[model samples]
Target: MNAVLRTLVVLVSLVVAAPVLAAPAADVDLVKQRVAKVGVLRGEFSQEKQVAGFKNPLRSQGRFVLAQDHGVVWTTLKPFPSEVVVTRDRILSRQRDGSSRVELDGRQQPAMRSVNAIMFALMSGDAQALAAQFTVKVEAKANNGWSMQLSPRSAMLGKVFTGLKLQGDRYVREVEITEANQDVTRIHFSGMSETPAALSAEEGGKFE
Candidate 1:
């Protein structure tokens, strides 16, 4: 697979999946309702990747800022620093040396235009947008928390992912992606805060 496509798949897989939601319609609605309340979210994340035949999992920790209408600034702080900025129109990756590496311009490639759509949708907790791509199943867990399992409907994605799961309370807390190649990536998010005001100057610059 192409590296860019692989990146897109990973980003999209973080949010969208297929299959069904086992919970009742009302419960699903409530989940969506709670998720929609988040606007500006800042958090820290720990990501673990387990690959087939690998002796140990690859792990990284990062900070992320998600502006519902703008984009996402994902900054990895440990295990090799890097940053990725995803907007509605493009995806930009930068190395630790402050040099640009990959830039995917959605304006140039029509297909890439939606690169961040599902990702933002997931971050925004839009169940309707998620249902368009994945067969969704929702589970209401204890302590006001909820879990969702999604299976891919697209054959292309099915080749890469076997299943995807998300869990959270008022805000999304974790994402688990299981690939067909016997690999998995699990991201746990913490220290999340939903800001009452708009994005700051530094945060807003990521989109540009």
Candidate 2:
């Protein structure tokens, strides 16, 4: 996928987790149901997005790995080699050729804290808890999982997603991130596998 589009997807789908996919797989329904059961996934995805204040959309592609308790990694391997690692405590980001940034809740960066909260909600896939946290509405849901539409319950979430759409299952298929300015970026996911795959802890954190 295009780098800009992938970036947009990461910014949107993973506003709270890794980026995810490469190819379509069989038993698509079975895969989604599995995600609902396992709750952790390893996959790759190609995405495209458009944000506010930008004339054109941004595109990108990346890999995603998630662990129910350990954490999640979203890595963009093109245009730039960058990664975000989210865990129980913090959301940390590093770029292969850039600075590594770390922010903890109620400690330093307020923006990072808010982003952490949102990502936590996303990773957990707890609709009731997330709904309580944000002004979220379930646009759709069933055995296949759900699509949660979220708005800022407080000024905090608003700053990150502005207007957020999370397409859920075990792995996400789409995420739409909008800015307060009404600029919209849509990330559609395909070619994802929800197979019960695991990554070593150290392997999970490494961007390369």
Candidate 3:
């Protein structure tokens, strides 16, 4: 081949091969770091719940917040104003009637236990962490997004839902959590990102 033609061919090969390589673990870690920096997440979601003995699946809508270093605050905005606060130490809940209840160990209530399991799944995308609780696998990948499939690792989780599809898109597009007994709960998050603002102790009192 001519000198100029050979030089051109080598340059094209390098350009084509560069993007085909997968990023290192550290590079992948950067994606999580940027997400964690926001410090908090506020979102709206719709839930469909079905249990072992329920005749019909229950449908509800609500808002939730995940505060940095504290815990998550889940507020039901439709069909009720019930709220669930899950902290590092315990899980507390309230209803529209202003009644308060606390359950430190999720094992106490079947529903709370199921809910907590789902919440933790949405917190991070660590492969090992999720694999421990669910049979997780990559479903698809693209330049802009990816999809992961997960099934509860435990029978208790299976009692709540059969499978889940955690889709990573513009701000975690959708969390499709389904009940093993034929109920489905798909929650979509939006208009939320990490913020530098902090939740005040007094302001947070409304939660407890």
Please give, for residues 1-208, the per-residue lDDT of candidate 1 as tens digits: 2222365846444333333333334346857766646568899999898888999998989898988778888888888788888888888888758764777777775545444766776665666666665677888878878888877756656777788888988888888888888788888989988764589988888788
Output the worst ten-in-a-row residue range by lDDT, candidate 3. 1-10
Mind sharing the TM-score for model 2? 0.65
Q: TM-score for every candidate vs. truth?
A: 0.85, 0.65, 0.65
Per-residue lDDT over 140-169 for candidate 3, one digit per residue giving the tens place of the 0 to 100 score: 456556566776655544554578887764
lDDT of model number 1: 0.73
Task: Give the distance in Å from residue 52's predicted Cα in candidate 2 to where it truly belongs.
Answer: 3.2
lDDT of 2 by residue, 95-204 (tens): 75656553343244333444444565564454544554455565445666667676655453455457777786655667776776676767655556556466665655
Model 3 bad stretches (over 4 Å): 1-37, 48-58, 100-102, 105-118, 140-143, 206-208
Winning model by lDDT: 1
Please, what is the whole-model Cα lDDT of each candidate in the order they appear? Answer: 0.73, 0.55, 0.54
What ranking of all candidate models by TM-score puts the best one first?
1, 3, 2
lDDT of 1 at 113: 46
Q: Which of 2 and 3 is ahead in lDDT?
A: 2
* Candidate 3 TM-score to native: 0.65
Against the true structure, whose TM-score is highest? 1
